[model samples]
Target: MNYTLLNSIIVIYVGLIAYLGYLGYKHTNSTKDYLVAGGEINPFIMALSYGAAFISTSAIIGFGGAAGAFGMGLLWLTFFTIFVGIFIAFVFFGKRTRQMGQNLEATTFPDLLGKRYDSNLIRAFSSLIIFVFMPLYAGAVLIGAARFLETGLGISYITALIVFTAIITVYVTTGGLKGVMYADAFQGSIMFLGMAFLIIYTYVQLGGFTNAHVLLTDMVHLVPAKLQAIGHQGWTSMPKFGSALWWVVISTLVLGVGIGTLAQPQLAVKFMTVKSNKSLNRATLIGGIFIFSMTGVAFVVGALSNAYFFKNFGKTALEMVGGNFDKVIPLFIKTCMPEWFAYIFMLTLIAAAISTLSSLFHVMGASIGKDLYESMITKDNRGSQKQSMFLIRTGIVAGILLSLLLGYILPISIIARATAMFFGIAAATFLPMFMLGIYWKGVTRIGAISGMFTGALSSIFWLVFIHKKEAVALGISQAIFGKPFLIETFPWMVVDPIIVALPLSLAVTIAVSFFTGNTAIQPPHLKKCFEGIG
Candidate 1:
């Protein structure tokens, strides 16, 4: 591969995103415009922006790495993403979210929930959680993309990180949500197309899908002895039931991401960017198709990479990637694809990274400015558009710096786990509150607060005190619980914080609402939310 050409393509790609950001800056005139694109984004851009944010470097590099380590069993995640994350999300949550957001005139996730409950505390606290926890997710995404560049293009990790982060931050800070959405639509298309091409090319290079599978199966004994001891036989096949690897794949990777999608603040906010239920409906097919191709191809190619490596290097794909796990797909592309295709794939990877990063940064800024700064810190400051925009850009810079620092210090081995931890926390804390607050009138501020607190704390506690890696890192003994948290007893996985916290939050909200006699006044705007939507 000509290094100069690769560098040139990257520079050109980033230049286009900057140009889009400049256009967005021209259109941004108010606080609402900065935060939610003035709620005028088209359904197609909304759909692609949602997809791009959802399918990040974490999904492609991190999950593909998991597939390399765990086998095709992780494919269940791809299925859940289409059926649960997209199909159900669009049909059930999308329209109501848009309607309610518009009714309340909200610009961020925290603002939506806070206004729905008439509680500034809810808004401020939720903003704090997002600002604090989002960096871990952001850092993980940064690491995944940077690792790919380091492995595939022989670039320094620091250089890759800085370049990728700078480009995303520039557009996000300048153009806000509108710029991010436009760039996401373009980048998302590249990701979808690149993944499809990579899958087809990988199959062809391995002598078709059937031959690839057979070769993968023939090398079953090549599975790492440690993995074999835990029942993993090969990269192409599923792990044996009731094994450690099986549990990790089922409980953590599949459920973590699938359930986590519903609560992702960045993705959920996209549902509010468009105007009507019809817009959300139109976006459903686009989002579903995008996810199916993007995630589906990543898992399929990840599994098949075993064949590529086994044939060429006499070792498994994971071995070739130096146990970094995230490098498997990038390495496969570098070794198997033509130089030109590799160049295209590099653009796709960068596009995936930058698109997701931009959205994350935008959501974080909105959370701070609209939810906390305006509502709580300056409760009497009378919502001035200029002041709000100033706070938002300030938050954007602060967020980027924090994420960069965390990415530098966090251990690479647990980056995937860290990413999963964030998703799990979101699922536990926000999913129940959002779902019930919209559908169930009995959801009081007290109940919503209780649920968010319980879910967020319990999930973090389990990850830190009970997870093997965290336990070891913190010098805590896991034997205190007799096994890893959620790995013991029936319904544990189902009762994991997300499951427990959500229902508990709902139950508390209902019980408390009834006990308190539904005393709080419901805003007239709340009723208007459902009007004209059915």
Candidate 2:
């Protein structure tokens, strides 16, 4: 097993992370520094950090497993991740977000929105949403890494989850955003190298790309009966367009996380970490390469793993991993890749999980303590940076525990579902107001509030009542109404909430703003927010 080599790699990685945390701690003199790295981080660090945080174990393990079962249809998500998530995010949203954050002196995403609209309620509500729902996403990230540890190293899931969370919480709570970003940059580099090797090695192992694709395509007859019934065509092609598989892949996986990336609090806050628009522009290529390598490799390897498994073991990747999609990639690496590469790839997964977890914890803590507590719970503490920072750190610990608990409670193969849920809900809730508030000056405070609340609630309602995953998992609909899901119509069960909720949110914002008609005055700070970045 080369225990010494594995141990040494892990130890060195941990040491490097600790050193970054120390650097963050040494530099974090004020609350602003703790929150946004004093808004002075270099472009390279911000780009790598953002990309790393955006593609976590959820992408590598969760969505990778999804590709295993669903085939290359998940590649659409990779395209969205690069074009919308990285390209548009950095070029369009990043410039305005940084301008607004610096102009408004906003430390958090909620702070930016709240201050721009001059509404504490908006700030508090946004924070509450983040605190409440982000754990689901965080839990997905935790479970992905935990599965890797459990499968690759023979560690118990519970122990892996706890150890992973503890390490991340320590650095994030102490070093704050600085530590999170620095660690993320380092982790992102490891991910880039690991994934590049993974894709190349996978192809070499399964013959060339053309040969592998042909083999996978020809193996369509080998797909499980259940998957075939659900419209799976083959490993190298998209599913049947109108099938249930297509609906889940397109509505939930593709549109959900793809569009949802725009409103992500953790990623959005990264825009505020640096000072100039040029920094964001410079980051685009770096971010594009990082995302493409990470997501592109994950989907390719995941789909191809099936062909590998079938060739060697007469089974698909999902069958080999016992139908738990989240376990597919971990099992693949452990059973297939060389010993040294397997160990290195395990560390890559760790880096992916920890980087994302650190950002989620930091954002959640800031939302709770900085926005919720200071702004709403105790307005008198608004000026107390030390007290607020303490509270935020406390919130970080609490968020970690909550996510760990969720990781334990959730069912298997729930990682991608949970990830989509969080992303969809976040997009539904915040995307309208966030994009409108930045681009459209006509967005009123009332409209923003109403839109966010309406969108957020509708997303929840859809998840509980219509979305089959939560409908079946939670059993609320069944308990109350004697059915697994409240909706009994075609495509309703398969349709994602984002398709409905996001439009409703956008409509409400536009309708409410038009009706209000100059009644709501823009804040003075907003004008500064719109000013071109110096």
lDDT of each: 0.80, 0.91
> Which lDDT tens digits does candidate 2 get at residues 1-534?
899999999899889999999999999999899999999999999999999999999999999999999999899999999999999888878898988888889999999999888889999999999999999999999999999999888989999888888777777789989988999999999999999889988888889889889889999998889988988988888988888889999999999999999999999999999888889889999999999999999998899999999988999998898899999999899888999999999999999998999999999999997888766655653657788799898888889989999999999998898999999999988999899888888888889999999999999998888888678888889999999998878788989999999999999998998888473675566668688742
Residue 307, candidate 1: Cα error in Å is 1.2
Distance from true position, residue 423, model 2, in Å? 0.5
Weakest 10 consecutive residues, lDDT, candidate 1? 488-497
* TM-scores for candidates 1 onward, in order: 0.93, 0.98
What does candidate 1's lDDT look like per residue over 280-360, in tens digits? 889999999999998888887887788788898887887888887778878888899998888888888888888888888
Total residue pair clashes for candidate 1: 0
Model 1, C-alpha of 32: deviation from truth (Å): 0.9
Q: Residue 466 of candidate 2: its Cα lDDT?
A: 86
